[model samples]
Target chain A: MLRREMNAPRDNIVEIRDLHFSRGARKIFDGLNVDIKRGQVTAIMGPSGTGKTTLLRLITRQLRPDHGTIVVDGVDIANLNKAELYKLRKRFGMLFQNGALLTDLSVFENVAFPLREHTNLSNRLIRHVVLTKLHAVGLRGAADMMPGELSGGMARRVALARAMATDPDILIYDEPFVGLDPISMGVIVRLVRRMNDALGISSILVSHDVDEISTVSDCSYLLSDGKVAASGSPDELNRASSELVRQFMHGMADGPVAFHFAAPDYAEQLLGRDSE
Target chain B: MPRELWITFVEFVRTFGALTLFLVELLIQVPRVFVRRFRLIVAQVYNAGSLSLVIIMVCGAFVGGVLALQGYANLTRFNAEDAVGIFAGFALIKELGPVITALLFAGRAGTALASEIGLMKATDQLSAMEMMAVDPIRRVVLPRFLGGVIAMPLLTAVFSMIGLLGAHMVGVMLLSIDVGAFWQQMQSTLDLRDVSEGILKSVVFGVIASLLAVWEGYNAIPTAEGVSRATTRTVVLTAIAVLITDFMITAWFLR
Candidate 1:
């Protein structure tokens, strides 16, 4: 990944306003607004099924919002046509929850993919760039191996390398720590911070792992009811007033997000004692 | 009007519209894939063409043998045993080559294309590519589609050639048919029209099979069961389409 000038402090790299999205009849984001500052790690945390990944999709223009606007680097993404949107997307690198390395390609080819597609770098230079990226993720030795031959954590690291291959202006990680060992989780968290600082790029990390977010992110937002319930540093969120934030931060099972699926009274249903 | 029925109708229309649009996009990208991504296309050609060679060859040869046996028996009863070679050649060239090759392609290459792309969608590899500013349609779908299209006709040619050779072997060696009449009668009887009809059918089937494979895949729901369903749909739809197109083409060509 190429190094770039650090973004101006306190300037926002991404901004959303009055965002609304729905799946069929269910609304996911209603009048939601959030901002990601330039050259910083911003963690978007929420409960399961709260549309953390959906928000990332909306930002990346993978899924358009039903209404409202998303501005990336001050360009209204909603208005961009496919070609313009693709041009805008060149600035973003996303890591999916499952790593999502190309199964048919070797680890080196996977990392080299974006570069080869987007750049005309010669063979020798492509190899150097690929190796540099793989080296950054500590998987240079495993470059020739197929993705299937790599472990879950190794796959994630290679995906990280691929994500960083083109030196994007912004990096988006959608549940990067979802299915990793604790050591892997620690490595990813450290990489998120280090890559952001070293490359001077903003990163949007969508994760619910409180500890990892706390360790990695410069700013954190806890979402509840399609809006930010709390926004601050980890310590600030821990001492926040919102019940939902407290439950999320502490991993409490039952709070604003219910533990049940809104069914009829359980005992009554089982006994058939309640009239329709 | 029941709600379920209404929903199904709407879903059908939506899928139809999507497929039509996808067909147009594939048409546009097929030529582009040929121009820039020659290596990718070649790799997929090896996958769909070279990998399916054995099954296509074995089935074609067996079919030819069966055809020769049946033709010899029937022709001998009529005291026109020399027509057996002509019979096998006409049947193989006009119908079996294109139809069976397509069915086999559906089973072999078609299923592979659908499942591979479906898995890629489910795993978010396509989305990752989009985020990397690469069009998955151009980079992934088109190469595979082009390969399948290129492979379909070549496989048909291979199947026909091998099938004819098998018929010749069985006709001369097993049935005691005259070697000269076996080949010479068939060659004289089979004209350009017959060969062109076969190639035309293969070309149409190629487009349909390749297009549907990638269509079902690129639009697959991103889940295990979704991918399985898409793969199944690719085979079923391609089979039905191949049959329908074959009948239509034969009727038109004969007319």
Candidate 2:
């Protein structure tokens, strides 16, 4: 199935090798290696600030790895110039955590932005395309409304519509289920699967929702300390041997992970007469 | 000595210095910015132009009325009531109209724009735009700047006309200056140079106001609180810049 989706060649749709990123003196992700096969939804699950979003940024070329190679569609994203990078970005869609639609523009205009910007299509054609995409996301009636008016779920869908407006080859969702109610979460997961199937576009879903991840993901990776600590099908992850993975997957708080409270340390110092 | 005062002074310097550096960098990379994102000029024009007509009319009308009263009062004391029309026309076309209109715009659109863009930056919209290969300056700042440029002169023109008319009404109706005499004086004093120079000042004001607002908005840090601070700074600085530029241009032209 992955082979058929690649269509053009055997190369991975998106490949990352030994990618390291640091903010100032602290290293975030180290020697992170991952591959996203064409036509598969790859779920990346990790603890907070373990660099899930950073990984997405690196793949999309919004960030550059200190030392590594990210080849997308057979071209190394690192070497692409500004114009080439722009062209490359056109092939991928990204759903942001907070549905970052332009507040000033109506939903119609928001969705039409990419089409109007990248193509010289006539206004009529652009309107048709925008409405079609909006309808696909079940938001055709909200076209005239501003993004500020929509519910969070609706806004996310609108953003999704805008992301899919350009009919990108790959779609990336950064924490799509964050801050969402269960119903909304279900709707988004279903939409992700539906869109992937309908458009035949490859997707990378980065999330921490274990239940949704298990249900929606074809293959999943456990990212820890900037490396793929473990990776397998969801079923395999359920049967994995890593303690950290098990602790994280079950959402256990009192295992090896300690919740450091500064107050306890201060209290201990005072009670033990260690204070100067 | 108050530490808060010192902190404020330091912050002021930092913001001004950073803005200056940003402007210099913007100037240096202008060619690249333009080449990659020229359509922003059109967008800026549209953003600034839309919804400006009503505010401009209201402000201009009141300003014109006040100009007429002040000019008439001062001129009449000198037994120069005959020059009421001259005072009103020359004052507005040469100086008061453009400066006042721009100051108003700086407060209204400038503050709102800076706050909105600054908040967007805080929320990571700019980052998303960058990821999409969209140039924020081109997609966001350029459109707003161009909009200000287009909107300002039109607003100034409205201001000039309304101010002159208010002066006319004051002179003819209230002060008993003959309509014909007033118009005659206006015809003589309101030369093409006066109109042209006012336009020139307004254009410069437009550039400064838009640049300052957009720059502050673009470089806003922290979060929404940062956006609010940037908005305040944009309004204050742009207002001062408008006043200073107004004086400099007036001195250069009138001298």
Instruction: Point to the candidate with the largest TM-score.
Output: 1
TM-score (2 decimals) of chain A in model 1: 0.93
Runs in model 1 with CA error above 4 Å?
A1-10, A272-276, B1-17
lDDT against the true structure, each candidate: 0.90, 0.83
Tens-place lDDT per residue, model 1, B1-255, is 699999999998998788889888878766677889999999989999987799999999988998999999888999999888899898898899999999999999899899999999998889888888888998899999888988999999999889988898898888889999989999898999999999999999999999999998988899999999999999999999999999999999989
What DockQ does model 1 achieve? 0.80
lDDT of each residue in A1-276, candidate 2, tens digit only: 877775767446889988889999879988888988888889999988788998998999888889999999788999999889988998888888888888778999989988877899999999999999888777899999998899988888888888898889999998888877777678778988888888888999999999899988888999887789789899999888788888888888865445453354676687886664
Q: Give the range of the ten consecutive residues with the poorest summed lDDT in model 2 chain A.
A: A255-264
Note the residue pairs that clash in candidate 1: none
| Candidate 1 chain A, run of 10 with poorest lDDT | A1-10
Candidate 1 lDDT score at position A65: 96
- Give the CA lDDT, 0 to 100, for residue B191 in model 2: 80
